[model samples]
Target: MTTTTATYDPGLIDMTNEANKKIKVLLELRPALDGFAGIPQEVRLLFRGLRKIESVDIEGLLQTSHRRLARGTSDTGFFRKKISAARRYNRISNVIISMAEKPYRNVLDIIMDYFQKRAEVASLQISMVSGFGKIKLTRFESKSFEDFTWRTIFSKTLPASDFSLVAPANHRVCSVPWHTLHTVGLSTLNWRSTPKYPKLDTKGFDIFIGQTPYPARVDPDTAYVIRYHDAIPIFMPHTISDKSLHQATHFYAMMSNVKSGAWFACVSEATRQDLIRIFPEVTDRAVTIHNMVAHHYFLENSAFERVPGIIRSRLYEGDPSKGIELLPKFFSLREKENFYKRSLGDKHFKYLLIVSTIEPRKNHTRLLAAWEVLKADVDPDLKLVVVGTLGWEHSSITKAFSSWIDRGDLFMLNAVPAPDLRVLYRHAAATVCPSLGEGFDFSGVESMASGGITIASDIPVHREVYEDAAEYFDPYATMSLVKALKKVLYEEGAQQEQEQMRQRGGEVSSRYLPEQIIPQWERFAERVVAERKSIKSSTTTVFEEKNSSVSST
Candidate 1:
């Protein structure tokens, strides 16, 4: 045999490295036949898709994931062909690496060996990716920054680097933002690591970021950018989920892995300050990257113009009379009444809106207490619309407010879609976020963007973000909220104040537009890339087992 070699572009070498990593990742994803034994084939397919899987036949990629998952794979030849294709794709002239030529056992070992030294990748920096490791490994999915809507919005407005993705934002509110990525032509890269180690072979990440804390464990060669979304879980233990303590412990354990010059994407200045106050070592690296509002809000939707009442009713009533298209046949007269009655009730009335999950930290109970005091004296017909989903540690909240909900004075719309939410925010007299703590509150911004007055808690983040644009009140004291509520609801010239606040909403919230946040993200990514080039990956980097201990900053 002649010493054979084929010349190829450096890009092929990069592609080969990525292929090896992908193949190694697939090996770990072969669903255990134990519980999956009796499950439907559709379920198997769903899991496979989520695990970043592809079909053996190129045609299979075109099929609906559910259909493919339902059919399952029967051809052993397909697996052989799939592996062969990846190896073929990896081929380049004069390259010594050959997964195809090796024995199966050697191939597995070779792939494992490559991943073991993932830091020796083509790129200058290794960006750590987080695939909800905290939730996946622990089965603890209590509402956190990883579960926030900002994750979905960030993907659309900003170019995703290493760690941001919601996978499937099925909710209407999330659908537009998630799909916006495709319009922008950016793929959500996988952030998951194999059982061996993270696959940082080709296309080394400049910076790895997740909505939660994920320390890239290989060493100082990689920059492990932690999402310091909030410090409430550490401080307000009573307000967190039962498994949150376990999650926090896991988060802190990964802090030791941040030696390679960590950075932070702070949600607000107040959050940045809190981070610095707690971890002085990170003061230099922390940056205030405010969670942004979607451009759609400012462009075509409710930012400036209120919807025409005739058109709004036509859409709601399914009449199609205002030059709108025909409604689905299933949409009936009775359903329209149900939609209106459930949301707005039989009697149309303006209501105060509170958009937050039903949890202890939201201060809904305090708001309710204020409502009770205010309702007894004035505005008997005033309604309180609370929009959000049920959260943990909320039994007492439901118990206390159950009667109010029953009496119809308090209306709760859980997981209201974006269109309906826009309407609510558009028409609501005011929107309030009385949370005890937050990384960056969206309720006030979302509502304020829709020309609604905002009243938030006296929390530092609220002050920093709202800054006189919103009225503030003590969330702890019942009367404090009552007094503030009365001044806004009953006080004279309050309409003028709301109009003024509406103008300020457009002004203040401009800071959170995609135009604003996108540049920050670009600048941040540039800095990370430049920083990576400036400092080479240190040779003495430490690679250790997943130890569960929080390292001091």
Candidate 2:
């Protein structure tokens, strides 16, 4: 195999006389507030890598999707304790919305809604503060960061590093929430008879990077860059939650960004092509920069004995306090004890593992069907283990698991930290990735990084990202998956096949490690800044020529 390196000229422009030579970047941190889910996890990884680049000055935009930020840069204690004022403001806003929804004079409702839009617009105009509600610009408490690091740091394959970097530092927040900006932008279409995107105050930053298609436009001097993940909402709408709203928000915001000439950094080549398919003109502005897998997953000599305890502790048994209950026929107290005890020592206990949200697009139902056949015919001792949070439209999928869950042939665990997840990946018979659609599925690569074999759906992204490292099966065909699993799990020469796949996976997964991916980003940042400078210089030269001609006339 041959590797090609793209030549990058870093000295595209002289910066010796520039007051600020470092490119100042403000990255939206809304995704970081969410749990260790897909986009959120990527945000953490991106921040970690960006901090290591010396030429870039990165700061986080400490704002929430729907919650208003309190004013001032002061002490924001742990647990976001300073959000009390923001909470009170939200209560008032909710009251206004509820009143508008009431049976009043149709005229009164219209008038109230109008006033609400005006207020929201006014709130968005608040000057940018270094922090939200007394939180210092460089130091504040983020429970989300705390939770993420706690789960992944100890579980990392490499020595735990960047502990302090994960905390809140060099961040700024706005008084108005991002949700309000979206609402206001949409409202302007009706209120003024023309759509108007809300403008954000990004005065000091050279570039402002958003996690997705942002609802607001940044200052003219600041270049807006969208870290485009995928077009899933547009292409696979039915599989996602809030189908209508999600599609509308994504489409409208995307259109606005395109019209404003924002740069797009796509997560995969497949995703970049999807974007081009919708808007052909954005081809010049969009580029693919694949996602980086965290350093938490790697080859480990973990014993199979640890699997049972991980399953027992992390299994998502419905909460009794919340009036939610698991199946009445689920493992009995004595039966569970024996099952755990037996599995703790049973070297023959083999389970197929999949880590993805239990959503329709993940193709969990199809995987379940294949697992059932594998268990019934090929290997009766085979078990299926699912590790992911329950997503919307998942009732049927969960229903399919009931019988298997009751019989102790299947297990479901949620919030298993990186440490336990690495162990699960290393010891699984094979990690299955049967997503019907994806921009870049992280699980298969993470499994490979952990010295595990992969069985993936033969989708374009999977083929491009996983290459020949995984056994490909048609996502729509249960029998196809069954055959693929059989060849890897129980067929003749299976051990040799698995070993070969693991070796290939190590090479493939290395392409996404931080060291390999960060250089791409650094070059991209430099090029964007250099291009902007070139454009500015050309414009200045044209203006000077026009002035000289006017003086001669």
lDDT of 1 by residue, 397-451 (tens): 7667657655546666543444556677777767878999887777788777766
Which candidate leads the pack in TM-score? 2
lDDT of 2: 0.75
Regions of candidate 2 where Cα sits further than 4 Å from its true position? 1-20, 74-120, 123-160, 191-194, 319-335, 342-345
Cα lDDT of all candidates, in order? 0.48, 0.75
TM-score of each: 0.58, 0.83
Pairs that collide in candidate 1 are 6-93, 127-205
Candidate 2: residue 256 lDDT (0-100)? 80
